[model samples]
Target chain A: TNVDASSSNCIFHWKNSSDWIKLNVGGQLFYTSRTTLTNSDPDSMLARMFSTSSNLHPGCIDSNGAFLIDRDPRYFSPLLNYLRSGSLILDPDINPKGVLEEAYFFNIQSCIPLLEPLTIPRDEAPLS
Target chain B: TNVDASSSNCIFHWKNSSDWIKLNVGGQLFYTSRTTLTNSDPDSMLARMFSTSSNLHPGCIDSNGAFLIDRDPRYFSPLLNYLRSGSLILDPDINPKGVLEEAYFFNIQSCIPLLEPLTIPRDEAPLS
Candidate 1:
């Protein structure tokens, strides 16, 4: 489930390849980043975005130097948005910070945080 | 994400309610019990099956215990299957018990365990 608080748009569904079926809000579906999209190889960039087969979860900042986010899918860093030259700002209703915190409490780490400067309140800034 | 080792089939996808999109065998979709099911509704049975709205999650074994499985949708007891009653039997390819065990280890209690005696091997019987 890719939730863009920035756009207040949430995508909850399955993946076959690069194709995505948009989820209608207020529906019951579980999103888990599962991907081995039949049409796209595991090496493909789109595959990287949502594939659990790799064991290299998207935002994983490993001790090893093999990171793909900013380069391929630009994971963790929200590196995708940064390169595109825009912010992945969130909305007040979604509360990206708070939502992720709650999800973390449930131990769902794969729920990637999409924090963009546009959405952070004027009173807040990313902590170093 | 509905996984039936019964068919050695795993369909992980987003639901608009009645229609289910299929997921790849080894992919990431993050299946949660999420559903208000826009195409469906609060009163619809299909909506009841997969929705997260209305504060009702599927298969909730509760303290007060006003449960929903076995009647309208058949819940905690694999109510959905008993109705069809063909036996939503599982297959050896997917070890339902062990998978739920590991998920439980990580505090992921939502991964539903599909236990049909056929797949449970002759020695195992669900503890009452």
Candidate 2:
């Protein structure tokens, strides 16, 4: 979704259409929709970046015309998938610990619960 | 998510732990957990495949140890992602038409709503 620059009252306009919003995560080029990123979590960094009132990164496009983040790309797909759908489908090959790190970095709490089941051991011993 | 083969009463026990269930879609090897597939939609092919009483394809693992399906692998990732998360964040580069086809094949109704906005053009004409 592109921001309407000419409209004085358009509160939620991106610099360009979300299709052009490319992300550089750990040197890997990724593209995503603004609605998908902002709708991920209201308290997330992405939400704040795309918020109408927030001046954090009005136009998150970087020097190379991509939103840059110094984070592991291995777990990004799951994280973005979670944002888009509201559920987390982690790759079996990727360690949950690494994905959790990215979740915390991005403030995606919904995923923490799913990952916790995998990371934390259940108390199988019956208490006396 | 392993099916308790020993327990004659465990209706939902998968033939094996869901983590080991591999899906081979269109000659491409793809892995997925049973929960993700079955939970996608109670009316989907996967739900029937993993249904407790349905004898359709119990223990979906094929001779090669992977669940086989002849479909487009390119859009399968997004379909699996949608199933896991209950939302669809299709790749911007991937045509919505292809993904919609997969969604229909898999019986993911939730995604159809999201994709409809993209596929069906909004009638901008005012009521005459």
Candidate 3:
């Protein structure tokens, strides 16, 4: 669990006690496995945060010991779903624009195109 | 957080440090607030678990310190959403029947009616 202060590349092993991870997004809580976070997009912020090469141990932690990510929970929920199911299905009340912003912040490149079309208003001035 | 062994009523003050709580449902992790768990259905198991009158302190704990609930995480996701938004929207790939069973298990009476209709097959052999 020790980190070399002088090295730019952090090397640490993922905890083997459990594959499941607890997350606190903004003020909301979410639980998912390490696989779900990294498998979706290896380059995403979430993936990098939980990956073995990254130093996630020093991240902000909630009272419950869950890693804290400062992002809107409402938007983060749908992104978690997308990571789990590989589909961009948002609840009717959820704003696609909000989810889109979160997707970009998380570096989830795959969800951008799926969300971009939904963000556009159908009533927009038809490309005159 | 003391529970009178002789009296069934358990008296406990919810931790004041954070309204947010961590949950581990059948190995899956989730983070949510105490309000979201109880506000939707005051009489449900989740509400009772987080309620001041219930004995939730000694419940199972995960390695990361999340309260463990032994339930199917798949179906639990939609129920969590229902609690959040009071809407019964399910992903296209999710089974309505599964969610219905989970709703019943959690004693979410309000969601049962919404899910029942969705569970019935419209193509069923005309009521012989």
Candidate 4:
């Protein structure tokens, strides 16, 4: 039965090539994996876009078939990296407040706490 | 005089949309800018690939019109990031030795010294 199940799994999902996903966020292009999007936050809009049964699946695609997201590319970069590494390090030029807004829009709950601290003014920030 | 020069500059290079370049590196997608590649290392192969007068302009392109570079996507990620920012940070799972080899292949001369320290064995590494 175990051997039969393993063979069935391969048969059901034979197209391994589609695992990589491309996106045209704002004007910048990005490439990531379906596993990263779905596993990062199963409840988020990004996860829903890749979900076959979800209604939020992208309605727009670029000429290259990359999903089009009308969000700032600068903010999206860190968010995507966060999903990949679970680390939310941002470049010095990136405003934390902007990233926080993107996290909220994407509904990446895991990132909110991590970003909130960064958004707080230095004077009011907790002594960590 | 300044206004006349600025207007001629705009006319000569009026197409703003083509500044973004996409690449399919080892089946993974990447989005970057012509400025990033050309400015990173004017003498590097990457810069040559984007040069209009250079023979190395990509001969292979994927179905999505992204330049096809047959290389390890894992190592390419950090290199791309390094080009974007002057920093050479790597994820814990990424090997510095692999990144060094890629930097050499790509002819990114500026990155060699920054990466050499990370590739050295702990005992042989110079103290900061």
What are the models' TM-scores?
0.21, 0.44, 0.50, 0.51
lDDT of model 1 at residue A31?
22
Which stretches in model 2 have alpha-carbon errors above 4 Å?
Answer: A1-20, A58-63, A121-128, B1-128
- Cα lDDT tens digits, model 1, A27-63, are 1221222322212334433344345554333322111
For candidate 4, write residues A60-105 as lDDT tens digits. Answer: 4556677655455666889999998989998775667767777887
Q: Give fnat, all candidates.
A: 0.00, 0.00, 0.00, 0.00
Cα lDDT tens digits, model 3, B53-108, are 75533244565666656455767899999898888888877667767777887899
What's the true lDDT of residue B81 in model 4? 64
Please give, for every candidate in the order listed, the TM-score of chain B alone compared with the true chain B.
Answer: 0.23, 0.73, 0.79, 0.81
lDDT, each prediction: 0.29, 0.62, 0.72, 0.72
Docking class of 4: incorrect
lDDT of candidate 2?
0.62
RMSD for each of the candidates:
20.0, 19.8, 11.1, 12.5
Candidate 2 lDDT by residue in tens digits, A1-128: 22232422111223233222456877765545566677657888877776666567744456777777888877776677566555565443567888888888888777787786677645753454
- The model with the greatest TM-score is 4
For candidate 2 chain A, which ten residues in a row score worst on lDDT? Answer: A7-16
Candidate 1 stretches greater than 4 Å from native: A1-18, A21-49, A52-86, A102-128, B1-3, B6-128
Of models 1 and 3, which has the larger DockQ?
3
